[model samples]
Target: MTDMNNPDNGGHGEWPQQQRPQYPRQPQYPQQPQAPQGYPQHAQYPPRQPGQQQPPYGYPVDDAAATTVLPPVPAFDDADATTLLPPVPPLGDAETTALLPPVVPGAVPGAPPAAPRHRQPVQPPFQQPAQQPVQPVGHPQGYPQAPLPEGQPEGRPRARARHAAPAPQPAEVFDPPTMTLKRPPAPGPAGPVGAPPVPPFAAVPAQPAPPAPPAAPRGRTGSPIIEPGLQPALITAGAAALLAGGAALGQVALALVVALLQLLTAAGWFRLNGMWPARQGILLAALAGFTADAAVLLADSDGGVAAVVGTLGGFFLLVLVLQTFRPSDPKERFYALTVLGSATVVTALCTTLLVADWVPAGVGAVALATVLAAAPLPGPKQLGPVLGLVAAVALGLLVGAPVALGALAGLGALVGRRVAAYDWPSRFVHMTAGVALPLAVAAPLIWMATDLLA
Candidate 1:
């Protein structure tokens, strides 16, 4: 390689042929990877030396060729140039005039002759009338007139007279004449002034007394005291109470009865609230009841009531938490919580009977009361509740329980019946809640009463 800056090169900076270094021929590999099909193959360029400067890939290397001037393009002439667009059709004078191009003074040589002007016959100039003509009397001008009557002539004098009459004017308002009302003079020994005298004992034909208006048929008042299906409800209640009293002999047996009552309470409560198909709520409530019963059984006798109450509170919190996870609107969540919480409480109440010692006597009183209340005795509606209370007291005396215990049990049973009957309970309600609720309700009362009496 020769030095590019060497003066002996005559400032041309060219590499001399004799001084160029010999390089070894590159060894060809056996195979070169071919480019994949459809791809453009790039030319392999020889590697350049660090000192060599090359022109850009697309440009000519010679300086004179790069600077050569290109031929001048011919000036565009409108007349000779051909266009891709279709020829313009000839324009009418109106269209041409609308274009507003500079106007030539004379007629265009090749243009179509101007359409001959047909001067419309000159309309006589409208002259002002000496006097404005009067419009006809009846019909105004411009607006369409109504057709003349069938029998009337177009120029009848009578019809003309009718139209000519002045339209009646509206009456003026005036103060009405004022008069004072006076009471008639009463009949006396002198009688009315200038009236004929009547005999003292003369019988005037008695005017028939105005027939009294038929008294409005009185609408039926108040809900029926005895709900329908009371008979079946009474039988079911009595049977449940009897079974509960018998189950009192064994703790396990009583637990079973209580469990059954809990199930009925859950199912019936859901139905009562019109929340059918609330499988989750029903299962949750039933599970809570079972847990309460277990708690009661595991607890010491003294702690049984506390166990039930605590179980109730814990399950209520669980219900609230579970409801939070429910994918429901706030209204539906709130409604579910209310129905489920109430059902849990009522089911838990059944556990009280297991802890109470006077359960048999209390249950007996409940049965007696429910049976008496259901009887269709001939008396006022009050008689049923009255008889129920008396029967409960009598039952208590026979069973050797305190009078207050029996009364409390009886009252609780009646209340539970009322609850079951509310909102027009169906037959299913009568069978399930009507039977189970009486005992469930009485349980708490019996437990409390026994505690107090003890």
Candidate 2:
């Protein structure tokens, strides 16, 4: 195909065409052109494909295929203009030979004439001057310098000088005199012999002092405590007693146990649940006592009296607890009421289930809902009706239904006096009713168990 980028093809060629002198085509020959001597035509070749050996001529057969030319190319100096030109690869050996001067196979232009190399002049070997015989100087009498060889360097050959370093003048010794000497000698026939003339140059070579003795080790003496597991053993023993049903003795025993538990929890023996574990202890003890009393009642018909005594003691204890510790704050009041009331309700329900065979299971649910709904009524003045309702419920659980109704009416009349203020006396009615309610229910079961047991 014709190259369109050519500028030498005249206007007919889409560029300025070079003035032409067309020549006849050369005849094809079988022989290849020869290269000059001592110069390689093509020895370096790129890596070949596997299983394909290189041509002996060091180039691909496609060299002849790249010979097509359209026209003289337009020269471009700028990189942007060069984009219009067709690409050309670097020259091969044959192409490179065409660009250089024709080689002449003859002698080199700058070779020197051949001859044998000249030898350097030699000098005689180094010789030392004769050494005069050495005389011993500053050496001790018996020692002498050894004879030197002819080529050896001269020096005052070292005599073995002992480097004794003056025996490091022993550190100055200061010995104090324990006693003084008498100044005058006794007078004799020679008149004391001139006081035993002292020496003019006496040297008292200083002597080293004795080293100090090492100190004795200090002694430690005290009575050692041998107890390893004492605390844990004590705790285990106490825990055994607590878990062994000692709570049934009386309220005093119950109170002490509960108090000990609170103190231990406070002291971090166990985690403290809250300000007081009274509520939890009360509930636990109540459930335990109720369960025991119920089991006894079921097993022995005559065990009512013991149950009654125990139940009365426990219920009275819970009442005394509630009354003695008045609420110190609003939250304390709320919590006290919630805990005490819930425990009392649980105890009451347990007693009801044990004693009253006629109570439907739905009674507990109905009773709980009524108590919760009634507790939050508006003013203290209205507490009379609340107390009356509470007394009614209490009497209903203990006495019969008719007497309970009478008690509710009676409570309303009693609490109606001095209702607006914080009436401690009036509040007592509600408190005492709440206290009496649970015990009234429990006392019967206890009495029944006692009678059977007796």
Best by TM-score: 1
Reference-based TM-score, model 2: 0.20
lDDT (CA) for every model shown?
0.70, 0.36
Deviation (Å) of 81 in candidate 1: 40
Residue-level lDDT tens digits of model 2 in 1-454: 3354443332233322354444455589685566789976643245444444333333466653344323346786565665666544332233333434333222333557645434434433333343343432433343343455676544433322332111111122222232211222222323343344333336567789888787787664453221112232233233324522333454334334433332232122101113243645455435544544454455444453445446545664665576457757867665655555444433433332233221221122123322332344566735634554455456345534333333332332222111211122223223322222322233233323223332
Q: Roughly what TM-score does model 1 have, to 2 decimal places? A: 0.50
Best candidate per lDDT, number? 1
> How close to the true structure is residue 258 of candidate 1, measured as C-alpha lDDT?
79
lDDT of 1 by residue, 1-454 (tens): 6566554433334556876444455688785588999997655545655555555344566755444444347798654564543444333333333434332222444569766555454443333333332323443343344455678765332224222322222222222232212222223334553244333445657688998999999875676433535665566565666556556568778888778778988898888777888898899999999999999889987899889999999999999898888899999998988999999888888888788877778888887777777777898976987899788878777888876888898998888877887776677777777777777788889888888765
TM-score of each: 0.50, 0.20
